[model samples]
Every structure is written in C-alpha cells, then in structure tokens.
Target: MSIRAARERGRRETFARLERKYRAGEYEEVEAEARALAAASRRHSRRRRPLPQWQARVLATGVAVAHGRGTEVLPELEALIDELEPVDPEAHVLRLIVRNNRVTVLNGQERYEDAETEALGILRDVTRLAHLTPLWRMELSALGALAVALCGQDRHEEAEAIARGNLPRAAEPALAGLHAVLVRSLNGQGRHEEALAEARRDPPHQDRRDSGLLDLVTAEALHGLGRRGEAEAAVRRALADCERHLHPAHPRIREARTLLGRVTGEGPGD
Candidate 1:
C-alpha cells in the first residue's frame, strides 16, 4: 500500500483506541493520549500545513471539558471551530459537534443565557443539515441542550414543551435523555404527579447509563410527591447504576447521593 494509505490506517486505529478509553471513563488517560497524538500529528506535518489528524485534538478538548475544565477549554474549542470550518464535507459536521460541546460547557458552568444562544444557533445549523442522517444526532443533542438551558433559566414550561414536542423524533439512544429533561421540567413546575407519570412512560432503555438518569429524576419526582420510601429506593438504584457505569466523580453520582441524603434525613457527606 501507498504511504498515504498506511498512515490513514494507523490514524484510524489510534482514534478507535482513544474513543474506547474515553468511553470507559478514563478521561485523564484519554486526554493525555489524545494530546500526545495531536502534537505528534502536527509535528509530522510541515509547519504551514494543517495537522494531518484533527480529531485527536478535538477529542483532547472534549476530554478536558469532561474533566470539569470547561473554562479552560473554551478557547481551545473556539480555535478548533475555526480550524475545522468546512475544508472538507465531513469537517462541517465535526465543527458543529465542537460547537455543541461548547454549549454543553457553558451550560455546565451555569451560563444559561449564553448556552441558550449557542444552542439556538446550533439548532438552526443542524436543521440545515437534516438531509444527512448522521447529522440528525447533532440536532437532537442541540435540542436537548436548549431544553437544559431553558430549565436553568427557570423557564421550565418552555423546556417541557420543547422536550415533549421532540420526543417522537428523538432516536432511541436519545429518548431517555430527553425524557429526563422532561421530568426535570415537570418537577420544576411542581407537577410531581405528572413528572412521575412521565418517567414511567419512558421507552425501554438499552443502556444502563440512560436508565440511571431516569432513576435519579424519578426519585426527585417521588420526593416531591412525599413518597419518601419510594424516593429512597429510586435514588439507591440510581446511585448503584451510576456508580457502575459512570466515573467515580461524575455529577450524577453526587446528585444521587444528595438526594439520598434528603430521603434519609442524613447529610450528603454521610
């Protein structure tokens, strides 16, 4: 095979390994590996040439955000967005994905209005790419983030409307996340019964990660309804699922623990 073909094969293999490590909740290791890959790829290319492998750099940025370094990574994400701007057909979708990550980071930082604005733009951009089936995931993700931003701003009713309106179109993998948002929106409105009912209406979850979130939300709804025993059970299930599927320090685990404390009249530190 030609040198170019061999290099492409090696790049794909490296990316596959990085993705697996990222998914396994090894963020620190994945971040280090991705950064090393990006630096090496850039050095291998001529000084004025674009890095032969952009995905590694993007992955590193994402891993940084995952590490709760959102403030630190925002500038990097912006630079990546500029670098990834449509030099190729695939680059546009990747650019939008990076933008989505920025919105997520802003939301994580509680910058609701900023996240809302970013998510709206992403929605418009992704809608224009609807012809590409794979790109539809970006649209769903942006919608989810928009709902979250609205919730953050205490606009729960609007969040509920958006989530309910999009439920039918949310692919199976995204259904549980949207449903979790819908439940939180309902709980925010003090509609505990509705929230509990909504949680029960969830389609079967294929991934434990998704079900764990629903469990946490279901506990909240139950707590709001004065079902302390049920709430404790749900929160315990959520804690177990999250502990197994998520990073040790993931926010979901902390949220579940806090709710458990509420249910049992014990402090979160316990």
Candidate 2:
C-alpha cells in the first residue's frame, strides 16, 4: 500500500480500538490513549502530502518537535524541502511548509534564527497565496506571529491583531483553540480586559479539551483582572483536564501550571 494508505489504515484501526475503549475501557486511561492516538494521527496527516501538503508537513513537524519527536520529523522535513527547493518559492508548497516547519521545530528546540527564517519564508509565501479563505487567513496570521516571535520581533502586537481580527468569527466557528492562542497574545501585551472579554465570550467546555491553552489564557486574564479566586479555579480545572487528556509532560501543561502558580501562589490541589 502507499504510505498514505498505510497511515490511513493505521488510523482506522487505532480509532476502532479507540471506540472499543470508549465503550468499555477505563474512562481516564481510554481518554488518554485516544488523545495520544489523535495527536499521532494529526502528525501523520501533517507529514503526508495532500491539500496544502507542505503546510501540513510543516505543521506535523512542528507538533512532532514540540512533542519531542525530534529527528523523526526534522530529517524528513529537510529531505522534502530539498525536493521542492527548486520550485517557485511562491508555488512550491512542500518547500514552503518544510521551511516553516523547520523554523517551528527548530524554534521549539531553541534553534532560534534558523527557525525564524524558515517561519518568515512560510509566512511570506502564505501571504502571496491570493486564493485563501478566512480560515487560512487567520492561520497565516497566527503563523506569521509565531515566526516573528521566533525571530524576536514585536510579535505580540501582530499576534493580537490577527487573533482579535478573527475572534468575533470564532464564536460561530469551532476555533476556540485559535481564539485561546489569541487570548495569550492579548494577555502578553497586558490587554487584560480584552483577553478577559474574549475568555468570557467563549468559555471553555468539556469537549473542547484541545483548547487547554484557553484555560491558561483565561486564568491569566482573570488573575490580571484581580479575580484571583476565579483564576485559581480555572487553573485547577484546566490543569486537571489537560493532565487527563494529554501526556503528563507536555510543555503546555508545564506552562499552565507555572503561570497558575505565579498568579495564585497555590498548587493545583490547593
């Protein structure tokens, strides 16, 4: 079978097992395994060539690096980029994604300048893709901010602009996770009120666990708003949910707890 076909089959089998777990396995363990499978599936999709194939590769590599998939993702990215490097920079989608993926992956791994350049290149290409949707536009902006952040530029302002621009539309769509990232960008800029407003406007929910980042942003905004008690509660809930749904050592989980402790001076169990 083709690589794509194989991945698809693996995913189908994994999810079939997942369904059985959902039906009979222990709740917490099954949920945890399901989340892992979902992450792996996303990584698989990102690496496989399909629509916007390059971007998918980059995104997949980024997640892989962020989750410490390490050499498994980066080498593949480099090889793919090499194949597409001769293509027009604007249309060489695979190359562009590989470049950007390099940036996100390296940046996550603390290889700053390299990552920044790759990310910027991807952003430039994304901007030039005249045929973009509102969804893609927001994603491009957010990715632009990520590149800028890696480059150590004034990224928060840009991130906030992109996030805010897309925030209103988010409520109607299922972009709570994107909105949550914007909330962090807002909070980073001390736009606490706007961040709080955004959080209130889109409260976290049970099924929205992918948006665990939302909890961190909301908690921080609340703490800044002098709603420490509420912030603490939100942190506890977010942390608990994240622990339940994600790998224990996820950096986002560490970040959430760190911010929570800084704000409330209390642990999750406190």
For each candidate, what TM-score against the reference? 0.79, 0.59
Please name the candidate that would achieve the greatest lDDT relative to the true structure.
1
lDDT tens digits, residue span 1-270, model 1 = 999899889888988988888756677888898888888877787745354457787888877765556667899999888878665557777788789889877876778999999999988777777776457767888898899899999999999998999988887556767888999999999999999998897445644335378888899999999998999999999999877765564556777888899888896532
> After superposing candidate 1, which stretches have Cα over 4 Å from the reference?
13-32, 47-52, 63-75, 86-88, 129-134, 202-211, 240-249, 264-270
**Worst ten-residue run, lDDT, model 2?**
48-57
Report lDDT (Cα) of residue 94, candidate 2.
42
Global local distance difference test of model 1: 0.80
Pairs of residues clashing in candidate 2: 103-115
Clashes of each: 0, 1
Residue pairs clashing in model 1 are none
Cα lDDT of model 2 by residue, 171-233, tens digit: 422355456667777777788998889877846442323536677778989888888888888
TM-score of candidate 2 versus the correct structure, residues matched by position:
0.59
> What value does the lDDT take at residue 150 in candidate 2?
31
